[model samples]
Target: MHLESVVCFFAILSLGSIATADPNPNQTGSGKQLYRNRHVARQQLLSTTTRSVPPTQPHVTPAPTFTPTTTGSSTPLAPAAYTLSNGEAAIAIIGATYAAGIGGAVLMIGGTAHPLAAGMIARITGGGPNGDTPEVEIEDSNPVTTTSSSASSSSSAEPTPIPSPYIILFSPNATAQEIQSVNSTLVNHAAPNSLSEVVSHGTGLVVFFKAGINPNQADAIRQAPGVGGVFLDETLGVDQLPSSEQAPLSFASRRSIDTDTPGSPKASVRNPADIKLQSDAVNSLKVISQPAGAKLTELPGYGYAEEAGKGVTIYVIDTGVNAINPEWSSMPGHKDILYAPGAAKTKKDFLNHGSCVASKAGGPVYGTAKNADMVVVKVPRHLHTSAVFTAILEVSNDIFKKKLKGKAVINMSLGHLIPDELHSAYEQLLDSLTAMDVVIVTASGNDAEKGVNDVTHYPALLGPTTDIIVVGAVDNAGYRAPFSQGSGIQLNVSAPGYVDCANGKAHPDTQGRWGTSFAAPAVAGVIAVWLSQDEYKAKLQVEGQVAARVKKMVQDLAYSRVEGQPPVIWNGIDPRGLSCASDHPTGFIKVFEKDGVASGYYDVSSNSTTGGVTENIEQWCLAKCTGPCVSVFLYRIRQSASDGYYICNQYNQPWTNNLVQTGVAAADSGVVFTKSLNRRYCNSPGKTVSRAS
Candidate 1:
């Protein structure tokens, strides 16, 4: 530590070769008085270093210390000044001369000082208070002032500098009185009226500070009793410039290619023997088979009539749904399709976008969740960032007013710039929607030719929030659609956008409907299927829990065209893991581990509508453990008591790497199931289980 110096000048009297002097009254009011003031100031500054300022009454206390020395009559004798290299050197120099009453007299220059310097003085002694010393302000060769007790006082060590116009997140438990105290503190120290836009959501409040306050104010705010955390209100915008690009496919009837074709590069129809039919209206249209003879169909749910979506509400936030159309009005739940007042109350599809999207969501014949109802939210033709934000807020509030809190899914096919400037606000809104049990689904965009990244869109690239799911379009041939935009980490899954529909026909069709716009609704419709089930409906009761589970179930069960590519969602709503028989028990679970080795995975099975998981699976690994295992997965699964097979599984596998090295159990645990809900079964649920050597 460098020495902090406090000095004074005195007049010298020469009676011989040697010189002696008395304190000059002009320089300081009586040397003894200056000494006492300096002593108090030094004590106060050091004592207050670890103390906090009172929020209600913010004030600075003064401490000062003074000293005097003998000098020649015409000239004052300068005190000995030594510049040490660092604080430690200054301490050593002062410690060596402690007997001379010059303890702590080494002037620390923040940096190191050299004794070999020409103008440096080595040692000198004078009378003064000896405890923690005051920081003496030296200006124009005279000692100006010597006391400092405020929190804003500058020192050799840097403090947490307060950034102006920053946001403070108050603790969840902060009271109104504590909030008032914080306001008083800011007013007294930073500025008279430094705060703006104080908004509260749930238990948290977001407030802004004025610009150009003392940079050290952040430290004070952090130390304040009521504040939880503080962050700078940064402005971030989309890196890619916004463009008026068109979607990959325009509105038209579905592609009507005959099952038999010759010399057509894209045509690859299934054989007659493999084609499965449910009714005349719903037929299993297989386009591609991966392992050569393996059959895949568009309408995969053939006989599962009980899985029709029931009591699920799909919000189509798109270019207005036209209710007057015969295709829409004739649907079972058509009366339930409500519209936002600003989006116009009439049933009019101005762009033919919302109609196609709504059909894909729940249009009875063409929809994924056959029985789910629809709520149309129309966005403006030419979108603005502010308007879209306002639309989200307005729609959220509308949902709240409508009392559609849980089991409500939002399907947005519109695309907008995710400017870097609005990342915080956008994130805050999405998080709020999630906490309220509302799930938002948005398209990954259709700008693959333009080389646009998936996250370039606002809601789609809103990062990894459990409540938002981003979808990309895939063609009938089980390949990623050439025009579908691919994302970095946020894209959840892909779905069929190329549905076969007849032109000028009464039936709803997805044939000509392409782009991520149509793809998003397909996934939304699939989520509606999950919501319809009593098992998933119970899970949806907990806000922000089901979206992650849905994504996981799809990831575990869905087939992909190529490895590492996003897997496409199941062709039909009733997949083996999403539906169940009466005897197939389902439950929720929380897994735990021992030193990254396997421990216990507890399963809480729900017996009634109240909801719970009652069983657990305990796994024990034989040594080879080295790291820690995180508590991942919140699941709802269907297991057959006799066969020990996981029939319908819905769980969240956190997208993080937990395994440190290779082992038999180190593979994706998501695909694994157990016998008797314990380690002995060694079975895989979604995929085939194999033994390790």
Candidate 2:
């Protein structure tokens, strides 16, 4: 039989016997209209099917009284009336009878049936012969909408978009309840678990929201009671340069050593084995000592106090240190490697940058401050600016809580460009930390290629404010490295940018690391050494004095081969005293002779002695003729006929020969003067003045 003929035959038979029932009193006008529409549609389907073939003789039969059946309960289940359209009713009937002919009645519907349609099929094809019920399979399709509720449900099935992360810093005075209330409001406005506390220091409570806040939402947050500022949390990376260009080790191929293995080498300056490992790599350490002069080929040994950085704690905020590395291990009194919360269980030095940094800062074998305690703060390898802020805040909070103000040093070998509005927030953070007497050392950044000044580099740019020490990079020769950012006043001091340090590998390569990342830690290590000293410890006891004192001491004791350049950092070990020639007074030179006439030289100031005086006037010149003192005059005043005392006079202007003097009378009256000379006197003539009589 043709498919249409079979379909028409089944359609007519099923429709001819559909029992009519009383109209549903609960149905509304729309429902009644829908029922009528379905009935009309069935009639059209029957007419179309019949025209395709000779119509079967109409067999008129009385509609059978519907009898309901119950499986377990005595109450019979009423048969439901279906409101399917004509096409749908025909498909159901064709499916049922076709399956019945195949010995097992199996009806397959194109889409899920409306509940009423399912009942209608069950009633039409009662249980098959021998009571074996036919199988019904529903192939999923676009939902059939026969009611308003079905349409409403289909519209609600779309996926929700995810929110982005943001950070909000609350005012310092915001109470816990107020903070909680604000958090509650934000949570209700965004997805669940949207607000989390990033840091809660004395300055403010920093909270992070994963709500992907819109401008209006951000404005709402800004206007909230007690809220200080709202910032979009942005991603950042380690300050270390990309390995392919400048870094020695490829980050992708970097390996981590198993520190748990037996016989691992531990770093200890006193240990013979540890010292041997460091003997070959002391160029960076050797260069930091004494004044910058001839290049050093061999290690003169790092001159430092035995205390090294004993009680000081260096918090390295970077990729995280390899705590298992022997460099951090085996220290007797100060071997504990502290970690911030959420950083303990992770692979500590995944990128190798952090380990190298920490090693240079305080590693026993390779660090400048070999005995310092270390706190490793592990941020993401692909660091975020918010994470950096949180780390800094956490360290500050930790130091404050532990009363480690002067003893704590934070080394940030990382930086990124942030929005202008955030600059104040950063300054406030550093200012707050410095106020607590903590020392902060940061890299000037390796952004020379960007052709921008360090003013664009943060934290480092904040160096001018005296709250932080910004360190740039220098080569082994003590000249500023080509890649080091900032010069002159932009940098506090420079350090060896390239160095051999632990890289967390089993067999670390000899290719030394390079970048301001390494330079920063070297200065930090020296700061640790300073903090470890008894004098600095006492001086730093005064709150807010650490940064200023450290800056002055580092600069005063720095090694500068060139006169105008910012000096490279020195560890204050065997400091070379200031040289008058090296002082390089712009237009002044050494006085070749001291004539017994004081008229030409301006007697700016004088230093005299009552006791025995050795008239080495050059030493006096070096002492008194510092800044702005252009000339010095040695004077001998007769206290008695035979005894005389010497006086040293300093002048602001160079002495001139035109001023007349009364020869021996001025000389007898003890008026003798020396004129300021140029570089020619020191370089060519090499003349010397006789001691005053």
On residues 1-693, what C-alpha lDDT tens digit does candidate 2 reach at each position?
000111111000001211121232112121222222111000000000001111221222222222122212333322332222222322333123210100112222333232321112222343333343332322111222221122132232222223456667665556666666556545433333444565443434433333443333455467666776777665431133533323444221222211111110111112111111122236677666533333344333454544567788888876556665656653322543333323444645655667778888876556777667888776543334455565666676667666776888888776544454555555666666776678888888675655644433456656765557888876665556666787666688888776777765544422357778788898998888778877556655566577778777777666553344457776644312212343342223444344454444455545446322355443444344444655565555556667655656666665554543446443433232343432211110001111111
Query: TM-score for each prediction?
Result: 0.43, 0.53
For TM-score, the strongest prediction is 2
- Model 2, backbone clash pairs (residues 3+ apart or across chains), number: 2
lDDT for each residue of candidate 1 in 1-693, tens digit (9 for 90 to 100): 000011000000111211111222112212222122111000000000111223345323211122221111222224322222212234322222210111112343223331211111223222124333322222111112222211211232222223245455455456666666555545443432444333333223322222223333444466666665555432212112112222235221233322221221112321221111122132212221121223334322232223445566788766566565433554555345443323445566545566767776766445655556677766544333333444555555555655666667888776543333344545555565666666678777666656544444455655344446878776654457656675545577777655532111233423344567667776777677666666555545555466566656555445554444456665332221221111221111233212212212222211211311122221111000101211222222223333221112211222232422224242223322221122111211111111111
True-vs-predicted CA distance for residue 367, candidate 2, Å = 0.8
C-alpha positional error of residue 76 in candidate 1 after TM-score superposition, expressed in Å: 44
The residue pairs that clash in candidate 2, if any, are 164-212, 589-677
Instruction: Compare the candidates by lDDT and give the number of the best one.
Output: 2
**Which run of 10 residues does model 2 get worst, by summed lDDT?**
40-49
Stretches > 4 Å off in candidate 2? 1-162, 199-214, 237-242, 245-281, 291-299, 331-344, 449-455, 509-511, 562-565, 575-693
Off by over 4 Å in 1: 1-294, 297-307, 334-342, 382-386, 401-405, 463-467, 500-511, 535-544, 561-565, 571-693
